[model samples]
Target chain A: MRYAYYPGCSAHSTARDMHESADAVARLLGIDLVEMKGWSCCGATSAHQTDRVMAASLPAANLLLAKEMGLDTVVTCAACYSRMKTANHEITSSADMRAAVADAVGQPYDGSVKVRHFVEILLEDFGIDKLRKRFKKSLNGLKVASYYGCLLVRPGNVTHFDDPENPTSLDRLVTAMGGESIDWPHKVECCGGGLNLTRTDVAVKLSSSIVEMAAASGADCIAVACPMCQASLDLRQKDIDAATGKKHHMPVLYITQLLGLCLGIPEKELGLSRLMVSPAGVLKALQPASSHQV
Target chain B: MTIKIKKQSGKSLRQTVEEMSGVDMSLCYQCKKCASGCPVTKYTQSPPSEIIRRLHLGAGDELLESDLVWMCLSCETCYGRCPMDINIPAVIDALRSLALEKGSKSPRGDMPLFNRKFLEAVKAYGRSYDLSMIMGYKLGSGSLMQDVEKFPSMLAKGKMAVLPPSGAEKKVVKRIFDRSKQAKGKKK
Candidate 1:
């Protein structure tokens, strides 16, 4: 199946592994990812706070671009998926409000394109059984905590692809790839997004709790859908350890990375080296004799 | 110290905070998940969840006097974890603004001055320059002895860059900042 893809800003920068792993998986699944050209930021936590119109407009513009391309958009990043889905919902459900927003943007938004999260597309379209059939190698005995951060689930109808309170899309995906998924509290908790800029201390504390909880729940690694989530859990873990005087060195992996590994993709191609905590040991435990060179 | 209740406006503190910030303060079930997950709550008397509860109790005057409001790093963990999706960070920010407007002094005297220093740094550079921010904070707080040993290591490791990364359109960022400040001023 062919779908228009929106990688979002983080996919281009810190979380480039997400894009790489996604591309590898799409190729393996025979899915065509046509990237939306000249796309802008999703306006994440900032735009929604400062200006509602701008927030809606940014995602709306991306939707319009996808519509122009004549395909339903599949977003890899959870935050992008949430923003795009929210914009689509608003434009379709509320006519008067949609008209005002369209007027502000000087474009007619007919809400033609459908926004699907990568996980949704995998579950609904690709199916977990198909993923299992495609897996050349299994992630046996790998304990993973499937963390679905706030943006992907909350605000209800906007992102109606899954049960926000108890999302199991990632868990199903992990199981399909032969990994054990752990049930843990703080799975849907916020990683304190852009608040890292204004409140590093707060970000560290919140992120640390998530890691601690995941560890307590017997998770060897935390699997995340958002780049910001990965960043908070991976990059700031050292600071959390320093502040609390406890060592938390859990390797955080993008769900797509795990999928790629299960599909027998080489570790270097998956950009496993880019991660702060090496996923080599984790990968080796998942797949014996899988020495991660480089 | 006896806790004295003051009678004032028709609306309670909870009502006012909810109306202003669009956060349902009563939705906070006091799970203290917010406090438990909070980074800076350990340094404050009242945690974020407690502050929200106080506001819900119509303790507007008393809420304003809280150090909790100023202590919030606005990391948005509370908002992210909240089942109700209440923007707790924004509510805290609103409370801080209200306290400043009402001439309520921070129980921790360094907080207000630290905020001003951050704003001043942002205004001047159109972005946060960490060294300048740290210097400003130290000068404002009168605590230079803190973390002095780590500074050399940080500089050596290139973690503390002397200058911010280039490519920031200073004029455009400045305009955005100015516009937001003006809008905030008008609201005040």
Candidate 2:
């Protein structure tokens, strides 16, 4: 299958490591992600919180591009995916929004384009059975706390992603990779992705709990699909420890990075070195003395 | 506990917010389900349900001055849990827009400063350039010394793109901003 891929602004900035791993995994999995010639930013929370017209129009510009390409839009960033889905919901539902987006982009938006997340595409479009068959190395019961930041599954009518409260899409993907997907209470916790830079104090208060909850679930590492969550948790991890008086050194890994490991993709190719928190210790403990596939 | 009462001008806060957000304010039954899921309640003065309550009571001035509008995460957790299907985040956005328009002094100036710089970058270039926006935010907010330690490591690890993003249609994006502003002006 093919899609019009949107590499959000974070892919070039804070989430380059995630972009590299996810791109490598997508290629290896035989899904063709065709990027458009000229794609603009989706204007994340800054647009949505401050201005309504901008919130819809920014995503509408990209949706217009995808519609022109005659392919559905696929985005890796959960925030971008949310914006695209929201723009579609607005333009399709209201006539005022439709007129505003049309006047903004200078193009009529009929809202025919479908926005999908990479993880969901892998599970739904690319069959889980096929993905499981390609797993070469055993996870050796490498337990993971599947972390879904808000956008991945929330405001159910907009995203239509999964169960808003108890999303299992990530957990299902982890299980397919021969890894143990642990059920943790904070799996769907909000990490305050929007307030990362401006009001980090608020973000810190929210992100620290996810790390603590992961440890409580007996998981070695946390897997996430959103860059905002990865950046908030991984980048602020040391600070979280310093502030909370906790000695936990949990490595936050992208779902794609974990899948890359199971697919036998080289560590360098997956950009594992770029991760702020090292996963060397966690990967070292992946093997048992018996080397059994249990 | 001290309760503050304030009188609002012509239109009730509920009518204005409902018009801007398209979410019917009367449906909220004060179930407080949204409060249970809100993450930043500890940091803000009001919970999600209480913000709605303030709107119902026509406490516009109180809502504008509170830090709750600035502290929302936009995580949609409250919206997901609300039985009335009220999108508290949307209502908060509307309140924030109203506050910005009214020029109410925000307790947290850095948040609006950051958003303004972020959109300014998008308005200029087709996509957001993180470096320049951060610099503008630092200069504007007078917090230049903050996060200075992370730059060197970020560059060495290829975590940041030093140059501005190209390949997007800048003129088209600029028009989007101009048109949006014009549309808002027309509404007002």
Candidate 3:
């Protein structure tokens, strides 16, 4: 399966590990992930919040490039996925919006391109049973909280990706990779996103709640699909712990990184070392001597 | 307790919200379902239900002025929970856009400044340059000293790229902004 990959901004900077791990995992999975050439930003939360036209047109600009390539676009960032999918939804739903987007982008776009989250690609393109068979090292019942955050499943009509309330895609992925997906209510909770940069107080409150819930649920690690969620949960975790005066050292891992590990890819290659909260203890337990295969 | 409803004559704020958001404002019926699921409702002066209620009451610039609009996470929990499927985020987005247009004074800190800096980076670099965004935001937000302690660690960890990424899509991105502004100008 071939895809025009859209790595968004975080993948290049803060979430570089996610990009590297996803790249490695794609190679191992035999999926051809040719990056969409010189792909621009998806306008993310900022664009949509300020200007509607820019929001639609920014994603439309990238979608048009993918359309030219004649391959469906696969996005790793949940925020980017939401923006691009919403752009496609808006363009396809209304001719006026489509016309405006075309005018702004200086190109005709009928919203013909399909934009999919890479997690969806892993599920639909590579079957669960097939992925299960390829796992070299089973997670051996490591409890994982599949945190979807906001964008992956919310505003159901626009995204239409998974269940808005109770999404099981990440859980199913965790299960397929031999980990125990913990039943947690905060799976779809907001991580305070960009507020992590602007307002640390609010970000700390929201992030600490998420981390506390994951820890309280007995999760060894929180698995995320969005880079922003990863940053919010992992990078701000220390501050969260400090703010609450708790000793919860919950590690956050990208889905790609976990999949890479189960497939026997080295931790370094999966960008494990780049994680703010160390996954050292978890990784140590997953080694052959201490590991249990089911 | 008796509720004093301010009945206003002329164009309703509900009509303005509907026109701005393209969502039927009347679809919201004080169900409070949106407020119940809202994650940030505790922080806002008026939750989702109250925002819409005020809109129905023809409350004008006050709705735009409230910290509630800016505080909204746009997480769409309320939108998802609403049985009426009112698109609460979209309505909030409209309110935010209006706030930007009107330069409505907000008590909600530096979110608006941060958003503007983010888009300015996008407009300039085709994508967000994290270092530039951080630098610009710190300067614009007048808190250059806030996250300074984390910079060395960030650079060491490769979390912040030193150079801006160049892409062939930059020109087209700039054109997109110019064209959108032009289109909006013509519309007005």
At residue A94, give the lDDT of candidate 1.
64
**Residue A69 accuracy (lDDT) in model 1:** 90
Ranked by DockQ, top first: 2, 3, 1
Candidate 2 structure quality by residue, lDDT tens digits, A175-253: 8766789988997888876787777677777888888889888988899999989988888887678768897788999
* 2 against 3, candidate with superior DockQ: 2
Which stretch of 10 consecutive residues in model 1 chain A shows the poorest summed lDDT?
Answer: A285-294
> Compared with the true structure, what per-residue lDDT tens digits does model 1 show for residues A1-294?
889898775564556788888888888789899987656556554444444444466677678778889899999887778778766765776676477457545577866589888888888888887777777777776898999877777655557756766788888887776778998887777676544534566667778888889988999898988888887888677777887789977999999999888788888777677787778667776653233210
lDDT of each: 0.70, 0.84, 0.85
Against the true structure, what is each candidate's TM-score?
0.70, 0.96, 0.96
**DockQ numbers for every candidate?**
0.12, 0.79, 0.74
What TM-score does structure 1 among the candidates reach? Answer: 0.70
Candidate 1: clashing residue pairs, number: 0
lDDT of 3 by residue, B6-59 (tens): 666776667766876789988889989888888777776788888888887677
Pairwise lDDT winner, candidates 1 and 2: 2
lDDT of 3 by residue, A171-209 (tens): 998887778999998999999985777767787899899
